[model samples]
Target: MSEVQELTKTKEKPLWYVVFTYHNAEKRVEEHINSLAKTEKYDGLIIKAEVPVQKRTVSRRGKIKEIEEKIFPGYVFVKAVMTPEVMAAIRRINGVAHFVGGGNEPVPITPEEVKRARIQDDLSEEFKAGDTVMITDGPFENFIGKIIKIEGRKINIALSLFDREMGIDFSPEQIMKIQ
Candidate 1:
């Protein structure tokens, strides 16, 4: 193939690269890259930016809430046809620490890794409220508890402690449904 043909072939397929950003700046970096991608100069070279996140349930002060937590904090995945200009522009963006690779060149992430990172854990579908579960890990191991509430991946269970009924929150991995 001719040099021009090779270049065209390469540019046709955008690759996913990992960009390291400042603390708590993943979203900012992703937005900046995506906005720049829409501009004429970067229209074809920069495809899109993504910050993989998963829904999480947290109980604070007896209140259950669902939150989106970053799967990889301080990192953003950018899909683009990487070139010298594109890489330079990304590095110049605020909050972007650097591209994740050796030396000054950025390395593309494998498709398998990207797919794995995007997978969200939906543990709430496996168990429901009012179900009996046994604590599988932590100090409450082997203890039986009744599920009182389930928020995303967090499960609130009521169990006997010190002869008193109390509620505690646990992740799906920390509890198993009683058959």
Candidate 2:
């Protein structure tokens, strides 16, 4: 390639950067960036917005269910040529917390890390608070409990064990919802 062509190519090439968004708001933020990129000004400056997710399987009442989980909750990856205008536009989107970099400038994620983060890990099961479930793994295996709270993959349950009430936390993969 000619020197000028090489220079322009390098300048226009997009790098992967991480952006923070409100928990569970990755899709919204991605759509917002997509709309903005379509505008006349940001057309080529912003390239892609992605939310990496994985499929999981869980059993409930003898039935299995597949669920999609975010690999990095509250964060999204964007491929774009870093520029003041592009950054500002992304920052202005609702639900965007900020770029992952702590300082004044944004830091791009390494190509290797980006590749790893994009891999989908499959798992099983989904449950909600107030559902009765049975532990399938961990120390409480075979114990029946009622889900009292759910935070990401962790589940807090209230169970009656040894004639007393106890509260414990477990991962969704370790418990099965029972009707």
Pick the TM-score winner.
1
Going through the candidates in the order shown, the clash numbers are: 0, 7
Q: What is the C-alpha lDDT of each candidate?
A: 0.82, 0.76
Per-residue lDDT over 43-74 for candidate 2, one digit per residue giving the tens place of the 0 to 100 score: 66776688898999999899999999889999
Tens digits of per-residue lDDT for model 1 on 13-121?
A: 4578999999999888989998999999997678788898899999989999999989899999988778889999999999999999988899888757867988433
Clashing pairs in 2: 56-123, 56-124, 57-123, 57-124, 57-125, 58-124, 58-125
Q: Which stretches of candidate 1 lie over 4 Å from their true place?
A: 1-12, 119-179
The 10-residue segment of model 1 with minimum total lDDT is 4-13
Cα misplacement distance, residue 72 of candidate 1 (Å): 0.4
What TM-score does prediction 2 earn?
A: 0.60
TM-score of candidate 1 to 2 decimals? 0.62
Query: How far out, in Å, is residue 75 in model 1?
Result: 0.4
Tell me, by lDDT, which candidate is best: 1
Question: Where does the lowest 10-residue lDDT sum fall in candidate 2?
Answer: 119-128
